[model samples]
Target: MPDPIYVPVLKARQAELAALSEIQPATRKAILPVLEIAPSEVDDPQVVSDAVDRISKKLEVWGGNELIVDAGFLSAGIRLPSGQGATMYATAKARSLGIGAIPVARLSDGDSARADVRNLQVEYDCGVAVRLSMEDMDEDPEELDSSITALLGDVSVRRDQADLILDLASVQGDIAVRGGSRIVLDVLRELEKVEQWRRVIVTSGAFPVDLSSVVPWVQSEFQRYDAALWDAIRGRRRLPRIPIYGDYSVAFPLLVSGPPFAPAPQLRYTLGDRWLFLKGRKNDPRGSEQFYEVCEQVAMHSEFAGAALGTADARIASPREHGPGNGSTWRKIGTVHHLDFVVGRITTLGEP
Candidate 1:
């Protein structure tokens, strides 16, 4: 597969997958998503297995397509994880399905993880994506090179075909955004000292994890610093290379644990480089009814992409179709719109 114009680092949640299902086929070609599988979502092997099964089936549609799949969340909480592990169960449990799932191997991953990544690289005949986080980048550039070179060797991937990813996840404040841009240039400076990579992706997320600070019933606007950070890097003069732009869409970079804390009906509408965050009171008796008004507001807004834009836009435009859905539904709506909007934005990038 050729290099993608956008790389959306997404959590493998139901809402995220649902949004992916709604994206137009032509739009899907613009993004190569890095799917993260969290093992802590469920404890029971059966349930986790079922979720992984569903994930595989959802991804099977993109068979013969390129996608980076990381079961690295397994590094934290072990359970039935990995698209590699999921699809391994595919042939024995169900009929065979083909998917060009490029495995990811981290510097801290164990021997088993390396083996799994290597097996996948060989099976698909594609190289792996090495995602270096702030923790990994904390080391000096020389040490950074050492760890990354060792990781690529462990996965047995040639540098020319490997994807070097700089994951600066969750740069929430202005200070962090500036720091993020600096990191991007620093990594680029280091890459100039190394061999060529098939693709160099910079991923980060600035979406606040919760809407706790916003006043209830107030529609607040927040900057998409993640986008701003990328723009700053692209606008910088004398850059080594223009790496691929990536972010977590509407989701935060750091994964939160426990049950979702969606206390009220909230709407996240992507308008240009900012999010129109609208929220209802917490613990309101009318569950999700606030979404109707929220949808109405979005539908009436000039930035609204109209009902025909995508499934989520259609839902936001038509409040009568079904009950105002819950938080997950809103996430799906927000993400679909974000994906649709950003795909076009990146196509005609004016940041530089």
Candidate 2:
């Protein structure tokens, strides 16, 4: 494929990793993933070191050819125990595993982190990604130009060799959708004249922080407002380039959805414009075993895509046979199912 059909900005956790590792090869070829490496638990004293150690272990088995490694979730200026920065450590570990991972740099990053980017470009001659947040887009086009220049600083990687990412982060409500798209147009104005970008990707998530508003033991639907925001930009706004679509894949960017051991089982199945949510019986004594019942409901749905879709689908279709899996197992199941659904949409819907 000349260009990937989709970009999934996934958290580098066991659930997401397991999902990526299990997707069919054909589906895998269609995506360029942006793996957001998570930092260590806050309770840990050596978070910086722990972050490095964990990411190193994660990449050793990542098993992907191309990815955008974003350590934006890690502590900004903190140096690894090895005297390197987060991105530097991640890309190096990826290289050792023969993975063609591109390191990401942000305009708002600390001096040491930016310096790591320069070293990657100058010494390694490798590709780097420049990610700008929604606040960065708030700048006037001229001011945005200056920010990009300042971020590139000393060794100055060529813009044509770089991927420019405009991240909206999270969008909600109808008003937010409209406001977010406007910001996108503002940041993109006259940007092409500034430089020829290798690729432009816009990523955001709309999955709610929790399911408190949803009624337990009932099936409900929620809008994927992030996808709607991208549509608003693609159709309503006139821009120089069509950004590659990316999202958090059923998870929000900044918030945890709920406690891992919640009484009710949760099921999130993705469709194009909305998600089908099935919350288990809250007061049931079965607790997590309720997942089997919920999973069975999703599997039997008309849009389930059947067991042939992926590992998750198989487990979903035969929950008892697979065992009453925990939250992590269900996360992997839902995420893998989402991967199949999104890729299927891209291929069938044909450039939305």
lDDT of 1: 0.75
**Candidate 2, residue 334: how far the Cα is off, in Å:** 1.1
Candidate 2 to native Cα RMSD, angstroms: 2.4
Candidate that scores best on lDDT? 2
What do the candidate models score in CA lDDT, each in turn? Answer: 0.75, 0.78
Candidate 1, RMSD to the unseen true structure: 3.2
RMSD of each: 3.2, 2.4
Model 2, TM vs. native: 0.91
lDDT by residue for model 2 (261-329), tens: 643687888876888889777688888889989988887777777888777788888889877777777
Off by over 4 Å in 1: 41-48, 76-96, 192-195, 282-285, 350-352
lDDT of 1 by residue, 233-335 (tens): 8877778888888989898888787765765777788877788888887777776798788788767877777887677788888876888888788888889
Please give the lDDT score for candidate 2. Answer: 0.78
